[model samples]
Target: MYRLHIANKNYSSWSLRPWVLMRQLDIPFEECLTPFESDSNWSSFRTFSPSGLVPCLEDGERVVWESLAIVEYLAERHAGIWPTDDEARAWARCAGSEMHAGFSPLRSLCPMNCGVRVRLHAIPDALAHNLARLDELWQQGLERFGGPFLAGETFTAVDAFFAPVAFRVQSFGLELGAPSIAYVERLLALPAMQQWCQAALDEPWREAGHEAEVQESGTVIEDLRRLS
Candidate 1:
């Protein structure tokens, strides 16, 4: 069985990616949760991950870090995780790569906090640009592949890569076009997402920064659930 070390479910966006992939694929794995912001020394993570990041996958002697790398590794092991056709697969890779490298401002401003939903008062131009680009990408994907998913009928790594973006857009109360809204609804309807949300709800660990932000915004955990 694969062993996955992850951070808090409520805020670890990178952890969610490979975990969602594993769950969606019905891959059996031992999930070891390392509460983010805990005093626990993450020395063990360094042994497995060069970057000392969460979402490290240990498969026997092989250790893989980085969410996208882990997803690609699993895709190699399980064929259907990526689109089969060459052209579609190429587009899927492009989508995943863009997600892996782009959207820094959105990530910085709207950190994933499954336990809180605070409306954005002012989104910086960079973040707005990122969101606009994301809207265009979603539109392109829907146009090229049709409704629901980035690569059409089936959910792939590309979809997993953007799942956090869906959460961010919803959490920040960003305006989404009809197509993007529809796609987010499809993503939320996935069993994997439901499971993740449930787990996040049950998790006890809460970062102080996130808590303070929630308090300042006057948004509670219940408010966050409503956003979902």
Candidate 2:
């Protein structure tokens, strides 16, 4: 049996990675939702994960922390989690690793808030750099491997790694034209993605931590409320 511990469905980008991957792949696992208020409250996470972080995977006695590490572990067991072709697998792994490590500016400036539909006043240099790089990488994969998903027709960990970004793009209105835009739409339309988003919508526990994180950046309109 496998247990996956995740934080806020609305705001925990790292937590979304493996959760989406596992759910999309139909891998059976129990999910433990950890409510987070602030960094100080993170110590409570240690009960389920020694790392004191959400998205930790426990497979019986074996435990894994770090988002990418969990994905890699799952990939080792489920061959379908990664691309079958050697070159494509390498590309996918590289893309996943890159997403794990780089693009700090975009992540910081545009926090993943699935509930909101907001737009920035202006595109700052750092964020623009990250977005440009993201669009380039996404487009490259679509053209090179022939998409709908990043790396090919099938949804893999690479797509899961970027899943939060798709939500961010939808919510924040970050413009990544052509196939990148279409790709984001496709990701959002996935049943697994819709399930995650709706759970976030239904969740009533709004975290102060997330609100404070994105409050000063720009304007935000909670999409659900607007629709209502």
lDDT of 1 at 110: 79
Q: Which number leads on lDDT?
A: 2
Worst 10 residues of 1 by lDDT: 218-227
Cα lDDT tens digits, model 2, 1-228, are 799999878888999999999999999999989888655656788888878887899999999998998998998898689999888889999999999999998898889889888868678999999999999999999999988788998999999999999998988889886889999999999999999999887777777768766776768766663233
Find the 10 residues in a row with the least total lDDT in model 2. Answer: 219-228
Estimate, for each residue in 1-228, the C-alpha lDDT of model 1 and write its tens digit: 999989878888999988888888788999988776644436766766778788899999898888888988898788679988777789889988998998888877778776556766577799789888999998898889875688877888899999887777666677878899889888877899988987887776667765565455434434544324
Q: lDDT of candidate 2 vs native?
A: 0.88
